[model samples]
Target: MGDITGDTRLQSRILEDVGAASHYRAWLVSLALDALGDEPVEIGSGHGDYAAEWLPHARSFTATDADESRVAFLKERFAGDSRVRVRKLLLPSTLDGGFSSAVAYNVLEHIPDDVAALRSMAAMVRPGGAVIVFVPAFPLLMSDFDRAVGHVRRYRRASLRKAFEDAGLRPRVLKHVNWAGFFAWLLMMRLLRGVPRDSLALRTYDRLIVPAVRASERLMAPPFGQSLLAIADV
Candidate 1:
């Protein structure tokens, strides 16, 4: 949600046309959901791109966004779904504690005060609960696409781990994802300064390369990637 920035319609289209990208995202969500309880919360649920996969597993799910427009869209998207609730919540939100788990994907880089945001996220969960986060990796890979997407900075493993520790969350798992995507992003977005959009090249990458890269990561994760994910405990 926080990762792809643009008009809401444009964002939805981007997610839809990206083909196999959705599978990779569902894999990440599955990893996060492993540690989650029945009642979970998703922060920055833009357009609910991954909602369909996550919703059925939750006893109750709260999808929150900083943008009122996005919240409205989510409200309509989940309308009449008894298990789901949509709300507008700008971070450092006044959210209460005791949720089974908290999750955010591609969100930390969007906030200027990412540590504070992590702290706020941790506060929403109960003791011994999980807080899963996924964020873009490597500041050097940043470009106009990242800027347009409202990314302040990308993360390294250490930086992300530090943020979790500072937030009073115990860092449990950290791994890089999408090995091929690292170089592809650098060449397309950084060196070439490509603008964000849905395209045949991206579709090919997602459809062909993504599955291969994911399969490789199962044996041993790459040292660097286009993004990093962490599973922390509160």
Candidate 2:
């Protein structure tokens, strides 16, 4: 229950209709979809984009977010879509039984109680079901941009795995992402500590920098850059 309703330039930049960010987000959703197979529940669904992406493959889909307005919008956006359902509920509180898989993209970092969140997700799914998460990587790399976006903390693979394990879930995959872009971000933003959030510089980075970095992800394995992905089972 962190106060994330802040108006910041960084929020505007990342949540805006930037193609590169959308592409990377979609790519991550695709990975979750592959792991989920024909049906899954999506937690922290912002605008329903991730659920929309999985609609064709998913037999049924449910999405929830703490933001009531966003949930209302999602409900309207998919009103007639029999495959989709949207609701407003806080994390782990809204989770319940029956889902075979769960997804929480770029979400764990925002919660103050990360371990509790993981445990709630574990309790929601069937014993053998999967829970996949994506979050910003490396606590040392935390910046104002993270704060603006309401991130309580960044994570390393081991720490994230520990959280899941402590919640009675078994880690299946945990890795870093956007490796090539990590140094660039560090140099331009973290080290310099001068890059303004949502500036032209950031836009340029998203356009030019992200494509190159995403291309490199295919060549490398997990533990790549500044973002982490973890998949665990209940």
Clash pairs for candidate 2 = 176-223, 176-224, 179-224
- TM-score for predicted model 2 compared with the true structure: 0.84
Model 1 worst lDDT window (10 residues)? 1-10
lDDT (C-alpha) at residue 202 in model 1: 68
- Candidate 1 TM-score versus the reference: 0.90
Q: Which candidate is the best by lDDT?
A: 1
Model 2, range 1-234, lDDT digits (tens) per residue?
Answer: 334433434544455444235555566666676568456778778777777777888888888777766778689979999888787766656457678888898888877788888877777777677889988888888877667678788888888988888887777888888786578667765877653445566667776776777777777784557788888866
- lDDT string for model 1 (1-234, tens) is 123344545444554555346656666777777877888888888788666578878788889887677789899989988898888776766687588888888778878777788888888999878888889999889887778667788999999988888777778899888888889889988999875556777667667777788888889979999999899877
State each candidate's clash count: 0, 3
After superposition, which runs of candidate 1 have C-alpha atoms over 4 Å from their true positions? 1-20
